[model samples]
Target: MVVEQFLTYLQHEKRYSSHTIQSYKIDLTQFGDFILKTFELSLTEVKYVHVRDFMVTLMDHEVSANSVGRKLSTLRSFYKFLLRENIITASPMALVKAPKVPKKLPVFIEDTKLDLLLDSEELFDDSFPSVRDKLIIETLFGTGMRLAELLALKDADVNFYDSTIRVMGKRSKERIIPIGKGLAEQLKNYISLKTLQNFHNKTTGLIVTDKGADAYPGFIRGIVQRYLAFISTQDKKSPHVLRHSYATSLLNRGADLNAIKELLGHASLAATQVYTHNSVERLKTIYKQAHPKA
Candidate 1:
């Protein structure tokens, strides 16, 4: 009942995306089931100790710390709602600590390999689908746009003469990013081809797709995998890695961090700052190899 109410609150008040709301509902439902089994109490009767015990059981089952931490976060938010409604006088999860998650650097292909991947003429073909696929890869690597942003692009969002594309990022915030000359030209050619093929549907905004339909997440992932399978050995070769590669390349070439942050539509410089670590490590490697000291 609590989770049902929470789901409604998230949909109506929070305005979370349907996918996000569904994920929250599943997570909370699992937690509710677990708590019910452990304590044999109704949702209204759950106490702090029961929550803590649930966490212990999760640990006993060897759930990853991150998983436990996320579940705790969901529970905390749920209980916060209860507290606000005066359903509970005290918060049980208020004192609960979240598991520490280690910061992992974004993985990216080297510039040489990226160039090879992008420049492989064999990858490009004269067909509409092939051109569209190539342009999608080019745009993602060119602008570091998130997969969702790329999939949401419209023909109107691109300006070939200005060499820029407007992207709607997280939270529906819009930002315009300049495209490189290479990618700009590629986009122009792709657009011209799209016009010739009559692929642009009036109602759809997606730039690349089969039969004018919008690309779902699975289609995007498959595209990335197919293109990357040739050039990357990295296990995580998704469109996000193309984003990482773009940011890393920009930082390596002396682009300002703040500028990159804005270009990538990151909310804060801190999120953009991680790429600097990758740059620093590269510099250290060069220093060690070039230095005379043994």
Candidate 2:
């Protein structure tokens, strides 16, 4: 199917994450189903009116503006791909405006709780996998790299002499991030242990499975969730919250915004400013707790 082909295009050429491609596939499939049932037309035959009808149908079904907006975004990307490859001459989503979504503050763990999590060995086991898992949490929380970036790390990417780690961010942009003495020690130990594994099946990735295979996204996310569940009770307990914790912690400590932006590999200051709001919210909560009067 053309949709499957496009998904492959995203996977191979665009470097879109599996999670992102799956969302696109689901959105396109839902829209295609709606088109087939209501208008008896395939995706290629969909018009501007039919696209509008799809939006209306989603609204009638009580989908939120944010969710419907995301689906519209998928349609826009899909139709743009079709138009680009000359499969279609025009895009039905060209005139559509997505619904505005309110910004929500990012959720993050507190510094003290993170301290507790790291200090408590009872939170982790005393095996090879547990040692690797402990370092995974340390790298994610300490370095603030995304899960994809972490999984992509090669041994050569770390410069032990300079105390820095190189990571490839979105759009294939490469950035060098500095690591502290603590993370350097952890990486040294991890590398020594990994070298002891069966040299035949060794993978290039820094994080690996029990069999020494490259760690996939789900595996890493499960690792994140497993450790984070012991400390945090937030509704959202993903790897990104650790990233949020990194950025927010820096902001709360008076670190330069642009410096944090560079550490995070954000393309713009606006993208990094959300941490400022998070910091202010944290301050307000502390004030309410410690102040003599409400």
Which candidate leads the pack in TM-score? 1
Per-model TM against the reference:
0.90, 0.86
Q: How far is 95's C-alpha from truth in model 2 (Å)?
A: 3.3
The per-model lDDT (C-alpha) reads 0.83, 0.89
Residue pairs with clashing backbones, model 1? none
1-294 per-residue lDDT for model 2 (tens digits): 889989999999988777789999999999999999998999988889999999888889889999999999899989998999999999999889877788998899998988888888787675679878889888888889998899889989999999999999886779999998998998988888888876325678888888888898899889889888888888888889999999888889999999999999999999999888988877899999999995
Worst 10 residues of 1 by lDDT: 199-208
Candidate 2, which ten residues in sequence have the lowest lDDT sum?
Answer: 195-204
Error of 1 at 164 (Å): 2.3
In model 1, the Cα lDDT at residue 91 comes to 81
